[model samples]
Target: MRIRKDYMGFAFLLFLAAANHWLLIPGQVLAEGSETFYPYLLNTALVILLPCYAWEIWRSRGRNDAPLFWEPGLADLGRILCLLGGIWLWADAMKHLGFILPTAFFLALCGWLYGEKSVRKLALLALVSPFVLYALFTMLGAALPQGGIEIWLSPLLVR
Candidate 1:
């Protein structure tokens, strides 16, 4: 039974869920007195989905018969480079600039690529999303990134 690429994604994700549950269950949850069935839940997910994915992939393998590889064009390379540049810029901005700056910058870059034309609208989104997200999560409850970037932005964010 040959495996298809799409089903491969399912398999890998199921593997990840199973792996994490096994590791975290004994390490984090077991130490406490909680009697949660997180491990059983993960095991059920694995047992149910993995065989189904494998069966589907096997059935579809010869039926689909798609091309083995579609080589990346120059535009694909350029887009990847642009994404890399954005990540590099984000890392630098996190250190020197506030989270608001790099985040908005990334959002603006992505939003523009997604075909936003109105400068005013883009600017509003670029600027407002971070605050909205911060407020929505911070006020309503969610964790925010506070990595080494925190040290660099401390003076600006703190004051």
Candidate 2:
């Protein structure tokens, strides 16, 4: 009766997702109307699927051969910290800078950090990805975050 180390983090995430689905989502009003329909469906799927995933992980826990992958070195810790900081900053910025600019900047930074050295490719991704995502969600009738910058630049960017 031994538990594999790598399985714990995934198990914890599954538990959290399921708990959030069952405990928190029910409290939130998700009627058969408005934009909440998608969230409701997603939550339903997660609530149904997460337990099965957890059970599978538990049943098929394998030996940790790549033991070093779990343990973070100094460089890995620094990169993780940078990513966390970037996420925090992005969340903060989204209130003032809006969704597109901050998201694009964050994605570009992430791409650069993850070894995307081609400036043209990174620039293309940074410029196009946000607009495409915004359009996709907007087409689905989802209201995206519109902040000061986006409002000011709407004439140039938004239709």
Angstrom error at residue 36, model 1 = 19
Candidate that would win on lDDT:
2
lDDT, residue 70, candidate 1: 33
Model 2 vs. true fold: TM: 0.60
Q: Model 2: which ten-residue window has the lowest total lDDT? A: 25-34
**Cα lDDT listed for each candidate:** 0.63, 0.69
- Pairs in clash, predicted candidate 1: none
Model 1: lDDT to the true structure: 0.63
Which pairs clash in the backbone of model 2? none
Q: What is candidate 2's lDDT per residue for 8-53, written digit by digit as tens?
A: 5566667767765676445443331337555566667766776676
Clash count for each candidate, listed in order shown = 0, 0
Residue 103, model 1: Cα distance from true site in angstroms: 1.0
| CA deviation > 4 Å runs, candidate 2 | 1-34, 40-71, 148-159
